[model samples]
Target: MSEKQQRLVLSIIEFLNQSIADGTVKQDDREGLEVAVQCIGEAFGVDPNDESQVGRLSIKPASLSSLFDLFMKTRERMSGSTPSTSTPSPAASSSKVDKEAAEKEKEKGNKFVSAKKYNEAIEAYGRAIALNPSNAVYYSNRAAAHSFNNDHPSAIIDAQKALEVDSKFVKAYNRLGCVFDRIQVESLSNLSWRI
Candidate 1:
């Protein structure tokens, strides 16, 4: 949380803290998000008790996402030939995507998953990823759909992609576990047959 890292990291901390406090985060994910927010809060200089200040920093979660969107576009502009290591691939960078639209596609994917339409869920998640290649959640959710469809290889790939985009994402790890669990079961069944 150095001032040098203030603008971007601070926005992330604010969004994550709000996501946890509002109870909008999934139950399984709350603990991890809380730990991250707590760690960042410790390094943050803002005093929760200070009331003398006439104003305080506040950023909407959507705004935080938009900040990333803006940065990606700016980075694309500054380096026209090749994307930096932190930037998305050239194919993904060429398109201007709306963050909120990507979120909507994710929601649609979730609905499709809940309905047991794994194919539809995968498609929706694919659209989300195409719109926002930087979002780990989209890849993680697509991994879920792929696993549900019994496409273990695709699930593994998507889960790995999710981790690549956001290393701290717990859901991507869970998605990988889902794929591995199936593989383990198959291996054990084969062993039993040989015995």
Candidate 2:
């Protein structure tokens, strides 16, 4: 592609990244994002159908999801309402305040996790859970800490609690599946040794 065309494609990619970061588009709108990228590629005389080029055009998952995504996803996991990609609700200001506090605690917990302070991370997550008992993420995060500490039974318990609060929570399902698999593997290993 010519220099001008390359610049245009880059510009379009940047715009899309910004939209994704701002949570203006839903995480599930990957197809629409791909179409938009394809259109931009075509406008710049590039082969939009090229798989490598398409892959390069796509947003990074970590970059695509912002803190807002976490908040919305956690809320969705608990409540059945689909969070609109718009301004915060005035009617739920008080609840939002509570959520914000919980999120702050979660951030601290995340930091502790990154530092490998498993026990402290668990405590922070516990605080978040206490503040926002309805948030599935709080339970899920605490379960992760438990798993890291090799406490599979506690992890399973917390994962179950998370799913109990939010049956549609995908992360909880994945965690539960992982814990179950681990338990099965342990049981089989013990049986083989015994035999």
Candidate 3:
């Protein structure tokens, strides 16, 4: 991993560690936070299991600021605070039409889906949505990816958003149905096992 990327990972880990130490994070949530840190470490080619190595990792000031922003956003999300979307970001507010760029991202997402990289596909579809939020296809594509990732809630949200954007979006309905069906099957299986 590049130095900057390494720094970013470390900074996120540090934030999580601080949250836990300060009792801001509940005991039940600590495991998930630890797993998230491990995933970040793995993504950046670091072994989070090695406490010595994790301690040696250095974080730059710029990376710290970015990490702080990310932490704040995450805190807000955890608190169920809705982000203001009345004003779009600079990239989204630009006058230039980037339909081609959005299409390119969609294609990239498709390629990732074909490769069975659902997480990467979700990211690509997110970029497509950012570039062109009006496209219902992007949301539907992301919904499919989220389903593949076993993130049923996110899949449902994306599918619903797609339908809101275009009520006639057949794929969104299909994906939403599939996700609900899977959840039902899983629930039934669990109940049967308990019985």
Candidate 4:
């Protein structure tokens, strides 16, 4: 690994240590270190051009243990399998292609959001939502972009829609709470200053 890659790994390791200190990572997980590593690989976006940084962007375990267990088990299962080893049928190939295209559209949306191009981001996310309507993340992401543009009403509507689709989405809940908090604080300040 390059020096940059080494530094990234060290930074993530430090984060892991802090999480452990804060009781984010349980002691039992230490026994399944390999599974954890694989889980990291499955979640992280490995660069196509730089496979060495496969687990560069590490994610943490959610509050739910069962879901984390499931993710780790799935990653373990996939670790033994090679991408080129599978002989996917024609229907499977077509389905995979469709999924990839949808993911590509989502990437474009994310790029626009990162660029602070809120309106264009919303449009890109809209296209992604059309391609994968069932995905709650698409709606939630667009809602965030809408919020960034100061379209709080539209953001609230989209966030509500996302929550309707996936009630378990904590991100949607957090965003909604933040929006409500902003409104509440503004109204409270106005009322207090009016007197």
**Can you give the TM-score per candidate against the true fold?**
0.49, 0.46, 0.50, 0.46
Sort by lDDT, best first: what order?
3, 1, 2, 4
Show model 1 residue runs off by greater than 4 Å.
1-97, 189-195
> By summed lDDT, which 10 consecutive residues of candidate 2 come out lowest?
58-67
For candidate 4, lDDT tens digit of each residue in 1-195?
454454344345445545666777778875465355445534543332342332332221111242343345334433643234222212222355566676787899899999999999999888877766666788889888988886776777677556555556778767766665554455445445445
TM-score winner, 1 or 4: 1
In candidate 1, what residue range of length 10 has the lowest lDDT sum?
52-61
Arrange candidates by TM-score, descending: 3, 1, 2, 4
Candidate 2: Cα lDDT at 108: 96
Error of 4 at 56 (Å): 46
**Candidate 2 C-alpha lDDT tens digits along 52-120:** 543443322212233234445556646766445433322323377788998999999989989999899
RMSD of each: 19.2, 16.1, 14.9, 17.1
Per-residue accuracy of model 1 over 1-195 as CA lDDT, tens digit each: 444354345567767866877888998999998777667756766432343210223332124665464346334544543334444432445244466788899999999999999999999999888788888899999999998897877887687677667666778878877776775465445446444
- 1 versus 2: better lDDT goes to: 1
- Predictions in order: lDDT: 0.68, 0.67, 0.72, 0.59
Better of 1 and 4 by lDDT: 1
lDDT of 3 by residue, 62-140 (tens): 2355435444543454455544531222333423467788899999999999999999999999998988887889999
**Global fold similarity of model 2 (TM-score):** 0.46
Report backbone clashes per prediction: 0, 0, 0, 0
